[model samples]
Target: MAIGGNPVFRGKNFRSAVATAPPVPQAPYGQNPYGQYGQPAGQSGYGQNPYGQNPYGQPSAQPQGQQMTPEQLDQMYKAPSAGPVETGRMTYDDVIMKTLACLGLVVLGAGVTLFVSPAASLGLMVLGAIGGLILALVNSFKREPSPALILAYAALEGLFLGGLTRIIDAFAPGAGFQAVLGTVVVAGVTLALYKSGKVRATPGLAKFFLIAIVGYLAFSLVNLGLVLFGVVDSPWGMRGIEIMGIPLGVIVGLFAVVLAAIALIFDFNSIEEGVRAGAPRRFAWTAAFGLTVTLVWLYTEILRLIAIFNSND
Candidate 1:
């Protein structure tokens, strides 16, 4: 899994960190693999003898200890091995818990916005948009994952989302709920497909994603400029422009939704790769952050798509 789709996953040496567990040296006949003469683990240490003589050439006494039976040795050898959790590596559970924590903070922050006045909500939205972007960039470029930064980004994004939802819903009743439902359905399907191995992040698809995302961003920037300069009177700026009686925003928004779905697939791939590669447990925060970012973007696109589609009616 080459980390290329999600920029946040980029530069993180996941594959390079794939730690292969060294094969355990088999114990002789009645001896234990852990240690000898009832010595604790690591007592012999690597390349050092626990009995007779030490690696330092010191004459150490070999204690005469009772040895284990064949049954005991067989049972010990048959025991299940340590997993990611025991090895202090990333796991699906780690990612799920951390992602939930980040999302909980987002919900908490959004709930706070709901209690504020409309004026305050607008202010919070602006604050969140700017502050979240700064934190996102900072966190993405960091060599290691920072839980604090990722959580903060989620909270700020929540503020923005809450305000945006309120504004959109006010204009188009039930649009918010519909958009949320749409996002959930799309995300659920994407995840299921990815888990089933039907959807994978390929280099070719990633390249196409990159190009499409860049094009979308460029168009969005141009549209924002037009709207700001009063060159486009429609509420959606260039997006509101109609072609054959159909709004351009409707078509573009759908394309953006597809892009967001592909991004989610990439995010899932990143998480799966990280866990398989035995990444550090803390990198679960990275996985959580990437998922949150993609999900947030997915929700926003769905919301806009709904809003644009409603405008056509």
Candidate 2:
């Protein structure tokens, strides 16, 4: 596991299973053909030849009527099909299904908030934001993931997002739709870049990302404080300020979008490592959670950026 990067992926679950598991010793060539307890060849507990004789008093090896062809011999040695816990480990199907489940719940919760009255929506959004924060923290620190908790987090986030989008849409009609499209574009581009090997979560880059996230969080907290204290009158607080005739948010938003995209790379790396390490199927929920967090952040940043631009115009 890569430490100090994203809280959702900072643990042993991301480590290689081969690295952690005890190694199996290989049998020496031409010795112990049965490969059990290093027993000598042609020996059994009952003094019978284990390889050539059956326990039912039947001769296991008889004179071959016809020699096997090369293709037949190759077929006989083919590997067995993989089970859920096999060396092939987690497949793309597992991650995709789990992620879709989480996203579906998010859409369900959002629907509830979107149709509700304004006052009720505001209350739900507040509750959802606080609940989502707590669940996100709990899920991040958990050693093993709980599907229920992860689903709950997604629902709460959906509620918060729904209300926020409604509020933003009231001011700027169709802004929410635009934001969704923008999120899709950004995520698609990031994923394509990742698959193309143009971006990766190298150690040096990961460390830099952690540092940048800390700085960004600190800035956000300060900006929120200023807004709450009435020090900044604009909707976006400090981000609404202009530098050289350009809104600060345009600059800050682009930086935040890039950071969110980098975070996606980290998520992808963690998922790839987890699958390669033969992590349990349940851990797919963790992968989904990490991706959801990144996607939500990306969408909100894009939504606010667009809103700021619309307001300025």
Local distance difference test values of all predictions, in order: 0.81, 0.78
Q: Whose lDDT is greatest here? A: 1
lDDT of 1 at 306: 86
Clashing pairs in 1: none
Per-model TM-score, in order, reads 0.85, 0.81
Q: lDDT per residue, candidate 2, 41-135, as tens digits?
A: 45542233435555577775534233345565445445343455564355567888888888888888888987789999999899889999999
* Per-residue alpha-carbon lDDT of candidate 1 for residues 54-165, written as tens digits (9 for 90 to 100): 5567774433343446566556556766777887888899999999998888777777788999999999989989999999888888877888899999999999888888
Instruction: Give the residue spans of candidate 2 off by over 4 A.
Output: 1-4, 12-76, 83-88
> Which candidate number would show the highest TM-score if scored against the true structure?
1
Give the range of the ten consecutive residues with the poorest summed lDDT in model 1: 15-24
